[model samples]
Target: MEKQVNAKPGTKQKKRIKMNMLIDNFQLATLTLPTIILLGIFAYWPMFGIILAFKDFKVPKGIIGSPWVDPIYKNFQFFFESQDAWRVTRNTLGLNLLFIVISTVAGVIFALIMFEVKKAKYVKIYQTASIIPSFLSWVVVGYMVYSLLAPQGGLLNKIIIGLGGEGIQWYTQPQYWPLILLISNVWHGVGIGSIIYYAALMGVDTELFEAAQMDGANKLRRVFHVSLPQLVPIITIMTLLAIGGIFRADFGLFYNVTRNQGALYSTTDVIDTYVYRALMNQGNIGMSSAVGLFQSLVCFVVLLTSNFIVTKVEPENALF
Candidate 1:
């Protein structure tokens, strides 16, 4: 009988493969380590501060050593009891909803118009012009609005007076501010929103449009039937995301644009501004954290619910 020998001649190749995998993992870690470390330090690590919501948090005592309150519901109770709570919450939700609707509709219209521009040079210039406002800080935007609407010397008032019409009280009137806030927000914000939708529109296959035109479809027919239908999924997804944050508002826009005027609070106040004022006036960290946590939880639930509804209606558009 021949002597039987058991051997694994492939052992060297197996070892080499293991070494390659280890090297690949090390490379991945090296590439991603900085981001991971920063997020751990800034985002996840600081989450321990959530405990401040439950404690009678004293900056003096620090978050950990601070005495925990037996009940934290009192903070929320005090908030809900105030008339400002309902007013701010309503304004926040209402104004954001209006912004979402108006900005989306206008942005899509502008994007389609931009897409139709035959001159490429003009198209680039138009795109550049549309996006310039988005680069400005909200503080700057607020000042721009002030320059345009200042009752005493605003551009609009000057124009109206020059045209022999009564110059309106541009800032004091609550009736006008809702319109001003909406328009100003759209003016400052629509550029970015339009750019996104325009980018998406640029990605669309022109073959669809060519085919529709070949079928003797007019420009309006092609746009309404083809272009809009293709953009619906993205529109739906964005709408869902915006709806999730309905409880929040743009702090700077409402705060600065309204000049933080007390009278304007009826129209411009929102959850963010209210919370900021609470922090400034009372220096109550736990109370402020409680408001933040409440807003976050509501947003989380809304996102899930909205995504579910979108999934049911149009699975392709659902975020999840």
Candidate 2:
């Protein structure tokens, strides 16, 4: 009590404010502590493994003890020299670009459609139905696709035969896979994706919508001028983030859904699947790490470039 009384006015007020802040936010801090710790353990801690990209890792030598490659970039050079490099890179960029465009459009459309559902019970039902597929494992989805597309006794083949058309070999044909994968990807993701936009729509100002209606705005005009403008920030941020992962692919979706058939490699193979195959077949830690690091670097550069453009075009929506 004496010490508190003796303290300078500024110091005492500062200490009291600090103490009050700590007391107020203590519960919030407790809630986040576990997440922070887990993020450190699982996400941040393993960043040290990035060194494997430069080192010739051996089982006996381990990460730190392994010798660095003579040329340092030899592993990266090996990947770039491989003939599949161009093919995988092209497919990764092309397919990811396609997914981003199609998924964004589909998600936005779905969200808009959902927003029109005024009945709470129906909304819940629709949301549950849409989100269920997102929770399904890709392996399960692969089998489901197989059951439909399998040449022998497949439902789709049976339908085709019933229609007087020949049963098509769906798996071996690369041409049909781009469309099949797109549909599968959209079906699996669009529901969850739309949920984000739907939440954004929920937060939109009711007064703006009311004002739009009063000014002779129809439903379509209101959606275009009011709803879409409100969604621009989130859409920009999501697209920017998606662009960062353009060099990567959903490993399970590509691997399991396609069953890793060599025939589909021309259309379905991506950098992640390629590196996974290389790692599994050769067990070359350095090469795989190099590919991962390359992907990261490309993603980082793309993200920065995209953010720069957004910052210039729409400073408010830019992430950083």
Candidate 3:
């Protein structure tokens, strides 16, 4: 006896999808062969060094022949017992948090203001000018800042002195560094962030704005009722990404801005700078790796928790 047939939707579409996937896989294999080999050679092959986190890494013997340890790891103990650990960690997290907040807010506001700017010529000019700061090397920026902010014969100081005001020791004053770092971070980074947010803003449907306008909604009401609501998903995801770096400060911004002053270490030092100083001062490879591992674990936890909260509140906005 002949069996009755059951019709299914999208069987043809599924067949096409499978065929396309096979074609894509074949093309990717051709494109990625060299890259995969390179990563295997230089990237994955070097992962063996990760064992140094467990071993007592000696410079002469190197990772391959290094001795491993178990009872109360000295690398970690040495790091913890030292006072620099807390200072560096606190500064790192604090400065990064400041950057995250200031950059996020300023970026969004800049994007909003850019959106309000009508002329395309002026918009592009302003946008270009804003993002130019982001492209400069921190070293160049540091010198430029020093040229402007230096106390002895510096531009700002010269102006202050011209006005008969006292010349402040900009580098020595720890109280001012935090504000300077915050402003510098925002100024350097906000443009790139604003561009991201502006791109997201452009994706917003114009019909919503039109509908709001018809209901006697002014620009302010339209923004609050239409624009901000549309922007929530983009905002949340961007914020989550920033939070992932809460434990990782921009090394250049913090270290360069402070001019690497030992006296400013309390206010200006961060995880990256601390690791740098540790390597410079202590020359301990194993301990540096351990500190890195600790930072990664904390950032991982923060990212996961933020994602979890986002999923509960707005599943659409959750990155995962």
TM per candidate? 0.88, 0.92, 0.89
Candidate 1, poorest ten consecutive residues by summed lDDT: 70-79
lDDT of 2 by residue, 50-165 (tens): 99999999889789899999898999999999999999999999999999999999999999999989999999999899999999999999999999999898899999999999
Error of 3 at 24 (Å): 4.5
* Candidate that scores best on lDDT: 2
Ranking by lDDT: 2, 1, 3
Residue 165 shift from truth in candidate 1, angstroms: 3.2
Better of 2 and 3 by lDDT: 2
Which residue pairs in candidate 1 have backbone atoms (N, alpha carbon, C) closer than 3 angstroms, thus clashing? none
| lDDT, candidates in the order shown | 0.86, 0.94, 0.84
lDDT of 1 by residue, 1-320 (tens): 87668655488888999888988799887989899999999989987777777778777788888887776586676678887888988998889889889988988999899988889899899878878988888889889989998889999899999999999886677877888889888888777787777878889998999999999999999999898998998889888888888888888889888888877888888999999999999897788888888888888898899899888888988988
Error of 1 at 194 (Å): 1.7
- Estimate, for each residue in 1-320, the C-alpha lDDT of model 3 and write its tens digit: 77658646488888999888988799777898899999999988876766776777787887878788664376677677888889888888887887888888898889888988889998999999999999998888888889988877799899999999999888888878888888888878888889988888789888988999999999889878987887788889999998997888788887787789887788898878888888889788888877776777899999999999999999999999
Candidate 3 whole-model C-alpha lDDT, 0 to 1: 0.84
- Predicted structure 1: lDDT: 0.86
Q: Which residue pairs show backbone clashes in model 2? A: none
Task: Give the Å error, residue 313, model 1.
Answer: 0.9
